[model samples]
Target: MVTATALEAELLELAGAVPDPELPVLTLRELGVLRAVHVQGTDTVDVDLTPTYTGCPAIEAMSLDIERVLRSHGMREVTVRTVLAPAWSTDDITPEGRRKLREFGIAPPRVRDGSDPVPLSLGPTRTIATHAAADPDPVHCPHCGSADTELLSRFSSTACKALRRCLACREPFDHFKEL
Candidate 1:
């Protein structure tokens, strides 16, 4: 007995509850991926979401999660749409999302000065010896809040993150790599 307006509102609320599959701390809205929500009649809800990265494996899981959440609320014929025009960036992450990420044991993306060098390296000579210096800005440890961290692996449980350990806290955490 729900009106179209009420159904749309309910669907949005359910969508808001569905977190990003890869980054559980961020919801689709917080990630700036939930572009549009439309109520196609009474039983159908259309959701527009942009993928964080091209060919991201999490997209499938996220779409499924959205559908599941909507269906639980008695929404039938839920349609999850993917859009990729503008693309996603760390800047798209809201302040609240950043706070959540930090609390969830992942350091938020740090703003970098353009003067840090294009390759973030001196030259080919240094690049051959050490790839470490090539990183423009050092990633801070999420646990200890220290800059003294080392990259353990380029890819974590998810492809979008890198595994790092805090030298001070001796704790391992994920770092959202700069794309």
Candidate 2:
């Protein structure tokens, strides 16, 4: 006989394993999108999720997937809630997600400490200064593992990714933007 607590544990594990539709290479756990999972009652479970973007279409897919996973496990009443407060930040992405992004030929958002140096310049120089902060951290070339890279476009195939070209490997790739 499976204990309620034990079942809840299993449910949590299963929910964590749900994959993101946009970034199929990473699970919700790695993406840090599964906020909470707990047993609501004898036959009920509740799941809290934070979407990468508020308007992200992937959220709907992910919510449906979470429900499917729990219902498949025999949960009679499953609730997948979207939590908008403390909105999702790229920093929320787990280290595993970062690694997966790199493996998938997408550079992960760099961590920011708030103390990163900001340059002061005006006129055309302001454009250059802002550009420097566009990617506050080093954008390593996913193809050749070199730090030499250039931002080809602020937009990519997805709203959250920017297009970048690697100087070393002369390859183009998407960079997961920082929130």
lDDT of candidate 1 over 67-97, digit per residue (tens): 8988888778888888887777666677888
| Off by more than 4 A, model 1 | 1-10, 112-137
> Candidate 2, residue 111: CA error in Å?
1.7
Q: What is each predicted model's overall lDDT from 0 to 1?
A: 0.74, 0.81
How many angstroms is residue 140 displaced in model 1 relative to the true structure, after the best TM-score fit? Answer: 1.4
TM per candidate:
0.75, 0.83
Error of 2 at 122 (Å): 13
Q: For model 1, where is the 10-residue window of minimal lDDT?
A: 121-130
Clashing residue pairs, backbone N/CA/C < 3 A, model 2: none
